[model samples]
Target: MGEPSVDNMFSTASNKPHSRRKRMLSNVYSKSHIMANEALKAQISTIIYDRFLPYLASTFDDTPPTTTTEQPQTQPGGGGVFNICALLSATTMDIVTGYIFGLNASSNLIDNREELAWFLDLYNSRRSFNFWPQEFPRFTAFVERWMPGYRLSPKWVDEANGEIEKWTADMCERADAQVSSAGAVGGEEKAECVPVVYQQLWKALSKEAKGEEESGGTLSQQLRMSLASEVLDHLAAGFDTSGITLTYIVHELSQHPDIQSRLQKELLTLSPRLVPSSAPAAIPDPKAVDALPVLHAVIWETLRLHSAIPGPQPRFTPAQGCRLGPEEKSYYVPGGVRVSASAGLLHLNEEVYERASEWRPERWLDMDRLDVEKKKDMESRWFWAFGSGGRMCIGSHLAVYQMKYIVAALYSNYSTTIVDDTDIEQSDAYTAPPKSDKLMIKLIKAYT
Candidate 1:
């Protein structure tokens, strides 16, 4: 046995000329692929200086609102007062979908109990069947379609996939229709539709469909399906990461009222933006909320401590054993062995962090004071909140932006006091979420 070829497995096939159209199609739906790569650089410039900072400054108000505390104790055999896991899942879905589709799809578990339950049920069902179809593709495919007692039958998986695909396609269709209608309505009467990646993707696919080469297959079906999967990946990754980060941030803030107060004070500076207003203008600019130091540090610390996807990011070792780490020492990792590292373990290294296990945002502030060599070690070897190299999270920046906004919005406008504190530990999985399903917190409105 030899190391599996690391060709298309890791690389984005969108680079080739033949596949350029497909790449373009992907860009239409993939913010990571299109907007982040080309548009974000320029678009960020417009928002970063002009709109972002001002929005952050507006979140703070003169007088903060007082919240009433009601702590819920675990009833012997009854369910815990707060299900942190479920809360996290709802938060993730809202933030991710909100960013990608410009829809406030988050069930806001704090308010809508029934919707939260429905969402968590669907989410768990999908999670239980994920690895089988993704990892052992051939076997799972065979068993699903033909074999009996396949716990998650092929029928169920297909139904789930179909439902998801239909949802995505509907979004894509609506976006496309809006774009076309806007184009038809000449002059300045055009309205900007929601910022969905699907709009761009449909445009690219349409172009490819019209200019199909003699031997090439139809772009309408294959391209659409491929892009659909890519969108699903973004939805799954975006929601899961942001949700986990939010849950941890809430947990930590609940435990440390002083830090929470400091954060609220910072948020208060944002004034009208912090005030809950129905107008779109009232919503703080995304870029500005992203730049708050305390907010950034809180999110960073949460990501470092409870990395959502912290398992082994395995890569098949090269046939000619390659040198890894700063030492450049060659280690013969057998060709087929899954060589990888874990952010969960790496983030806890004492060499990089003084109180490695402790949650301390101050450490990030003083990182510059450390010795150059020490700082280099931290940057190179220890920090891996996002996986390294090409496969690194494409949505890292987006995730950060969304998490900061959610935290800022919550803490700036209201105070969060934990209703229940017991069993706050996280589950051990690819998306290591809180073990408990509820996170009951009293939200006291802040007064301007």
Candidate 2:
């Protein structure tokens, strides 16, 4: 309710503080580090092989298995239509929390359908209420404290925050326990048992943190709250953003069978294709996955068309005055001015991107034909899915890893048919998902 303390790296104002916070865990978020992280690898393997694939193999999970009322012929599988949107959300939450608190202690939302449903229900409900408290906290607080019965958000909003905060606190405590008992033998623990980010942040804060008054809590207490604040944001973005992107990727690929087939072929080229049986113990080389041109194109094209955070990323102009716009007609603007740019608008620029509104992965693949400047403009300058500069999404590499792996696993083993995509168009919001918030798909298992 109070807006998790601004100490989280993304919301912090000054560059100095933000950089310091980032330095605490930047190394591990690097692609090299994520690929090599034993915990992540083990957890991902379990999620795909043990959890996800089995769930899909069930063909369909028709609740009640029978109904007197007529049901839509969403899929022929007969089990029932699956809400891929909810599944993707659950998958992301599991993976991100696993990375944060270690898989042993992280959520089993992927396996617990009921809990997964509950979590998403609570989480998505609050998205609409974030406007007041997030953008104008002081005003929101004033209304609540003075204007009796006049609240910007409902009571359930605070209740949802409390539930999520409690969940995060439990994970933080588990991470603390693991760190306290860690020793040489800790390395022998299960690969996914190591809480990497939590351990790093606690160690850094323990050494540097000196006073209780700064955050109105003792050193260890303050550190725990800070850890909760930071990781919660990371967990939210790490899952939601990637989940949205992957959902759109699946939706698009299903609509374009040829493109989906081509991407699957590309995924299969890896030494260990994500097929569960063929390579039970075979995890594809991260480098190989990263190198797949078609896979890259699909992801990039989806990001271009459906950026999760399609809204503006606001930035304050520097303290020193600077020119505002076009060099020829630019006028000086004072510092601290709120300036913003929209990834959604940039990606739709027709001059920079031919047939800008179309979902053409070829645009990325065909970039070699363009001159360097044009290529840069099309690919780098306009693309802002993860924002830019020091404040960019820190877990971006991990998000990419999870999305790519999940996609590879899915298409490698099954062909998806879009069952019902009514209201699939994205909502007009910062972290936009389909306004309908559901994507029914039929999973046709594939084999050689």
Candidate 3:
């Protein structure tokens, strides 16, 4: 509520200052940079190939059942099923944090399940509480101040938030140390230590520092908190939304095992395949993964159907009054009114997407069958998984890269089958996940 720019995700923060922030680090997040960055590739390889694969393979005691397609040398976990939702959440955190804080300071949640549980408990369990503070902050604060023991946020929530803050702060300090050391850590180690975003933002903002402000002054504190807030918000949004989308991908693919196998074939075609491995592995070029039509279609379909933030993204009307709706039925609406477009509704338009309710990745790939304009409308107009315009989800590209890689690595090694999916229909809210918050899935290794 306080520093709304890019820091406070909710507020319809202005574009001028937001642009400044974007300029500082947009290159760091660009497709070219991400694809070419050797450090990022190594970080991803370590987290995914080395850590996630080993952890997943260890979840089973018995060999996996062969698929209906009869894929050979498959190993499935006959042992008790694990929560794919939580596992993927941990995976997202590790990957996102590695990219954010550098590999040295990033989370190892994949290897450390207990801490993953604790962090998710602190982060996920508190979603419902956000409605009060986010929607009706003024009224909520008034009630809490006037009435004794009538706090909207429970004491434990404050404590939980403090823990999250502490966790984020520690990462911030470590990233600071890494970037301060500059090129001291050379070779593969240097790549792992590059605090990409942190270093960029610090340098950009440092140019503005007059060096007159004392330690912890309004300028210093605000600057520090702003960076922390931006990174942490990105951290939460990056992991949670991408994780939920990926969970849905696996769920949809599990239900349609044929689709899973089709995807697996596409994934295995890459030069540096993401095979099941405990040893260090090479990460394929981001372009290679992005170029896979099947993979792209599946990711798009999942986002269309299961957008993490399908809710209307609130936008304030311009001060100059604007026309509303189509030209034929347009009306002049006064400025300052809050307006929004919902991806949930936009995506379900029957005209834009045939059998829109259905999970069909072919619609995206079946472009030749569609008229050019129709295809354009579907891909550009109807699709709003990452929102639209200048203030769109800043981490959209990063999310897509992470998701594609994660999905690629996953399907390349193992085929997932739904063990138990109670209440898989997503929770209806700002950042939706499964209502049950658990998509129990069993994994089986699939040999190429």
Candidates sorted on TM-score, descending? 2, 3, 1
Candidate 2 weakest ten by summed lDDT: 65-74
RMSD of each: 8.3, 3.8, 5.4
Error of 1 at 99 (Å): 4.1
Residue-level lDDT of model 2, residues 126-232, one tens digit each, is: 99998887677789878988999887889999899889888787888777777666431247678878887877776677667763222122245556778788888
What is the Cα-based TM-score of model 2?
Answer: 0.91
Model 3 Cα RMSD, Å? 5.4
How many steric clashes does model 1 contain?
25
Residues 318-415 of candidate 3: C-alpha lDDT, one tens digit per residue? 99989988689998878998888889999999999889999999888868898889988998877999887777777888888889988998888888
Instruction: Please list the C-alpha lDDT of all candidates, in the order they appear.
Output: 0.56, 0.80, 0.78
Give the runs in model 2 whose Cα sits over 4 Å from its true position. 1-6, 61-80, 145-148, 183-186, 210-219, 326-329
**RMSD of candidate 1 to the true fold?**
8.3
Name the best candidate (by lDDT).
2
Write candidate 1's Cα lDDT for 198-236 as tens digits: 545545556656753322233455555655555566777
Whole-model lDDT, candidate 1?
Answer: 0.56
